[model samples]
Target chain A: MIDKRVGDPAQAVADVKDGDTVLIGGFGEAGSPIELIHALIDQGARDLVVASNNTGNGQVGLAALIAAGRVRKMICSYPRSSNSRVFPELYRKGQIELELVPQGTLAERIRAGGAGVPAFFTPSSVGTVLAEGKEVREFEGRPYVMERWLRADFALVKAELGDRLGNLTYNKTARNFGPIMCMAARTAIVQVSRIVEPGGIDPEVVVTPGVFVKRIVEVANAAHESVLVAQGVTYP
Target chain B: MTAELIHAGLTRDEMARRAARDIPDGAYVNLGIGIPELVAAHIPPGREVIYHTENGVMGFGPPPPEGEEDPELINAGKKPITLLPGASFFHHADSFAMIRGGHIDFCILGAMQVARNGDLANWSTGAPGAIPAVGGAMDLVAGAGRIVVITEHCAKDGSPKLVDACTYPLTGRGVVARVFTDLAVVDVTSEGFVLREIAPGVDLDTVRRLTGAPLLAAAGIKTIEP
Candidate 1:
C-alpha cells in the first residue's frame, strides 16, 4: 500500500543510508526525480551504489551525487557525455567504480527484478563482450546469454501525475525507466507534479500502480526549467 | 519521356556511401543498427559529424581494432566502440538529453515501415516470431531535428515497407523527414511523399509498381549517383 502524505524531498531522501543501493529513474533528463536528487545532495548521502538506465546530467541528476563525492559505484548501460570530464577523471583516479550493461539487457534485468524473476536468457549480447564472464546456455538450437536480476534498496522515480494511492503516469520520454525501477527496488519513492485523490486516475493510464510504489510526494512542476532550456532547440 | 530509374540493386557499402552524402558537415547524428551502421564507415574524410550513441558516448569514432575493445566503452547494442579525440563520456541521462533535448541534428535510423504522413514504425514488425523491443527509436524519432530512415524498399515477404500508413506500432507519429532506401531517396513533406531521387538503373514505373502508396514526383527528381 502507498503512503500518501505531504513531505519534503530532502527529508524523505534522508531515509537513504550510506552504502545503500539506489535505483534512479530517468532516460537522461526526461523523468529524473530532481527534487529527491536535490534532497539527497543536500543531505550529503555517501558511498552509494546507484543503478539506473544512465547517469543523470552533471549539474542536475545523479551526476550531482558524483559531483558531491557521494556515489561510490554506478551500474548503468550508458555513462558518458553529461559528466564526461568528471567521470573519466574519477575513474582514472580510482574515485568511483563503474559497470556497463547492454541497454536492452539492462532494462530487462531491472524488469526481471521487479517481476520477481531471478534470471532470464537473452540473445542480445550473445557472442559479444557483453556476454563475457556471464553464464551462457544454448536454448532451442541458439545460444542465449544469462543476465542476473538487479534489485535496489531504494527506487527513485518521477511522474507527471499521481494519486494518493501512488498510481503514476509519466509524460513522453519520462516513461523510460520509471515503471521498471518501481518494481525493481525494495522501497519506491516517487516525486510527482500533481497528486490527486485515490481513484481519480483511470486504471489504463496508471503505468505504475500503487502496489509497486511505496511513497508519493507532490511537487509543482518537475520539468519547468528543463523545458525552458529545451524550447527552440531542434533535434535530428 | 524515357523511363525514370527507381531503386537499383547495390552493395551495402554503396548504399552507405549514398546515405552519407546527404549528411551535412558538423551535424550531430545517431546511426541506427544494421545497414545504417555502415554509414559511419563511409563518412567522408575530414568532415566532422558527432555520433551520439544511446549507451552514452558522444564524438564516438568507428569500431575499435581487434583486441583493443574496452569493456567500459560500448554502444547501445553493447558492442564495443572507440572514442575519438576530444570525445566526452557522461551519464546515460546526458546522452539522452542530447537526443530528447534536440541537441542532435539528425537521426539516421533503420525502419520497418515509413508512412506517407511520415509516421515511423521501425521497432516492431508485429510478426509472431520477431522480438519486440522499442529501444530508443521513439525518443530518437520524436526528438531529432531531422529523421532519416534507411531500409530496404520492401520486406522479405515482398510487402512494401513504405506505405500510405503504417500497420505496425508507431515509433513516432509523423516524424520522418526523409527516407534513404536501396532504391531511391524519398522526402516526407507536407505536400505528400515525394520521390526525389531514384536508384541508378531502376525505372520510375518499377518503383511505382513496388510501392503500395501514392508516389509524388518532386519537381527535380533525378537518379542518385554513387
Candidate 2:
C-alpha cells in the first residue's frame, strides 16, 4: 500500500527553485529523465547548475532546457555531440560555463558523495591539465589527484519500470547513472514507464531500492533519442 | 636486398589490426576512440575478447543494423552498437569501478604524443575550441593492466609523435607498454624506444630518423606485413 507517485511530472519537480544544482542521470540518450527535465524547463527555474554525462544529445533532452536559458552551468564529461549545437553555441558566446571532468572521475566523485566520503584520490587526471592546482599525493610511488565529492540538491532519473513503493528497474545501458544519482541527491525523483504494485518487480531485479527514491512519475511513450536517430537528422 | 621507395607505412586499419594482435584471448578490453575502436573489428574470430564500453555496455557485438539503431544501446561515444550474447548493463559507477579496479585486462588508446619514458598525452592539445573531451582515456591508462597506443608516426605536418619527451599534457606517466604506428611496432622499455618490427619497404634507418627519440632495433627485427 506504499505509494510514492506524484500527481504528474511537473508536480514531481515543483520544489525546484532558481540556482539549485541538479544532477541528471544518463549517458547521452540512455537513462535521461526527460519528462522531469521538461517539467523543470516548463517550471521556469533559472540559473541552475546541472551535472550530468554529455549534457544531453541535441534539443531532445537537457539541451532543450539549456536552450531555454535555464541552465547557468554544466558539470559533465563530454558536452559535444553531432546533434547537439545549443551547448556549443552558448558556451562559445560565454553565455554558459562548463566544468569538464573525465567520465570515470565524475562517476567516482558522485559515488563518493553518496557513500559519505569527503574526498578520494584518483589517477584519472593525475598528469593531465585537469590536475592543475589540485592536491596531489603519491600512493605507493604513483601520484593520485584528489577529487572531492559531488553531492547534488536534487537528482532526476529515468527507469524502465518501478513499483508504487519506488523500487526501480532499468532497460539496457540506459541504467548508467540512475542508481548512484539516486543515492547522491537529497531528493530523488524518478520518471518511469510503468507503475506496478509492490510485488510487480522481482525482488532480485531491483537495482535501486525505494529508500533512495522520493517520488515517482509515470511517463508513457517517452521520447528517447532513438526516435531522433531514426529520422536521420544530425543537428538540433 | 632490393631497396624500395620510402615507406608509405601501414594504413589506419592495418595499424588497428596490429594493435588487435596484441590483445590476449579471453581478455576484457576497453578500446578508446579513433584507432583503438577499430581494434574491435580486427579481433580474430573465435577469440573471446570481451569488449567493455565505458558507458556501461559489456560484451559488445558489431554495430547495429542500419534501421534498427537503438539509442538506448549506444556506447560511450553515443554511437549505436549491438550487444553480443550475454551482454549486460550496470550503473555508471559500477562500470567505472570495474575499470579503476583493474578488472579490464587490456586497453588500446590513441596518442597525440608519447614520451620515450612511456608517458602518454592524447586527451587535449589545449587548442582553442578543440572540445577538450577526455571521456575515459585517463582512467583506462591508470587502471587497465596494459596500455597500447596506436597512431600515425607523425603529426599532420610530419612532425614525429613518438618524442624524447612530451610537451603536451600527460594523460599518464610511464603507462604505455607498446606503440603501434604507421611505420613500425615499438616497445617502450627502460632503454627507451626499441624498434620491434619495421613496416614492409621501410628501412631501419628511416625508422630511426622518423622516431624523435633514440631507436634501438631488436636483435632479430621482424618485418610488419602490410
Candidate 3:
C-alpha cells in the first residue's frame, strides 16, 4: 500500500535532522509552506542550509526560522526585499553565510539536479562577478560558465491539492519551485490545502507524480505570509 | 512639465511612452522593475505584446482591482496581478528556459550605468557594506534577443549615466542595444553613442555636456514630443 499521509505538520517534519540541506519552495511569499516551517522550528533542527528565492519578509516564516538561529547559511539569488529585516542584520554581523546565484542559473541547477544531470553550462553569468571562479568554455565562439546541480536532504513545499499517494497540484503562481524541489530532494514534505483519495485527482492534471513526494499533511486553511506580516505576527 | 523636468528633459511617463512606440506588435516582452514596468501601461493600442515574469507566468494582465489581490496570483515583483484569458503558468525551470533559450523577443530594463560599448552595471556598486541582491538581471540581459534600457539621463548627483566605461561591476558585457533616457534616444553601435532623437526644448550641446562619451548626431534626427 503506498500511503504517504501524515497526521500533522509536526509529524510531517519530525525526521528533519541537524546539518541537513533544505530546499524551501517559494518565490517571496507565494508558495511558502508556513505551517511546515513552524513545525520544523518546533522540531528543533539546527545548523541548516536553506535554499530559496528570497529570505522571508518581516519576522514570520523563513525570517522567524532564521531569527530563532536555526539556519547557518542561505543559497539564493536575492536576499533583500522591502520588509526583509532579519537576514541583513545577521548577514552583516557575520552570523550567517550567503552564496548568491543568478536567478535563472539557480533554477536550472535545481532542474538539473532532479533530472539526474551532474552539471550544465549557461551564459547567464558569463562575464559577471558571479562567473569569476567558474570554468568557462566556448561553443561556436560564445562563452558559457559551468554550474553544478543542487540537491538537498529535504524539501518543504505548499500545494493546492494532493492525494494520499502523494500526487500534488499547486495554485497559480504559487506553484513556483514546488515541483522541482520535490524532485531535487530526498524526502519532500508537502502541506496541502486539501487531500483526496487516490483516484480523486485525475492523472492528467497531476503536476507532481507521487514518485517524488515522500510525505503529505493536510493544512486545510494555510495562512498567507503577507497577511501575517501585516498583522505583526511572529512565530515562536 | 514640472520645473525640474523642464530643465532636465522628458518626464518619466513620457520616456516610457516614447520607448513603448518602438516595440513591434506580437512580441513577447519582459519588463524590469522601475521605469521599464511603466512601459506596460503605455504600450501602443494596436500592439499585442505578451508579458513574461521570471517567477512563472505568461500573458499576465494589469494589477487586479484593489482588495481583490490574490497572493498566489502575482508577478515576478510579488505584486498582485490578473491573468489574461490565455495566461499560462509553469515551473521555474521552464520559465527561465523561455528566457535563456532565446524565446523572448525583447527585454527592457532599468539601468544604473551603461557604457559606450553597451556593458551594463545595474546590479551592484561593489560597496563594502552593501547587501547585494541580484534577482534575474543578468539572465535577462544575456539571453533576451534585443535589450533596451530606460533610465534617467543622469545619476542623482548630476553625474552622467551613459559613460565611456562603467566603473561599477558589470551585469553583462556588450549586451545593451538601445537606451531611452530623459534627454535623448541613443543607440549603442560600433561607432559609439549615436543620437536618434532629442527631447523637445533640449539642445544638442546640453546632451553633449551631459553625456560621458563622444556623441554623434544621426543623419535624420528628430525632436521627441511627449
Q: Please tell me which predicted candidate would have the highest DockQ against the true structure.
A: 3
Q: lDDT for each of the candidates?
A: 0.74, 0.86, 0.93
* Candidate 2 lDDT by residue in tens digits, B31-96: 888888898889778788999999898898889779888878888777889988899888888898
Q: Is the docking of candidate 3 incorrect, acceptable, medium or high quality?
A: high
Error of 2 at A17 (Å): 1.0
Segments of candidate 3 deviating more than 4 angstroms: B1-6
- What ranges in model 1 sit over 4 Å off? A223-236, B1-226
Clashing pairs in 2: none
Listed for every candidate in order, the interface RMSD values in angstroms are 13.6, 1.3, 0.7
Each prediction's Cα RMSD? 16.7, 3.0, 1.5
Point out where model 2 deviates above 4 Å: A226-236, B1-6
Q: Please tell me which predicted candidate would have the highest TM-score against the true structure.
A: 3
For model 1, residues A1-236, the per-residue Cα lDDT tens digits are: 54565587875676788999999987656677877877888887699999876665435556656777889988876665433345556766778887866555677678889889999876544544446798889878766678888888899888778887778887644566788888888888989888888888899777788888888888785643244233632111
Ranking by DockQ: 3, 2, 1
Write model 3 residue lDDT over B22-70, tens digit each, in one string: 8899999999988898999999898999999999999999999999999
**Least lDDT summed over 10 consecutive residues: which range in candidate 3 chain A?**
A106-115
Q: Regarding TM-score, does 2 or 3 come out ahead?
A: 3
Q: Per-prediction TM-score, please?
A: 0.55, 0.94, 0.98
Ranking by TM-score: 3, 2, 1
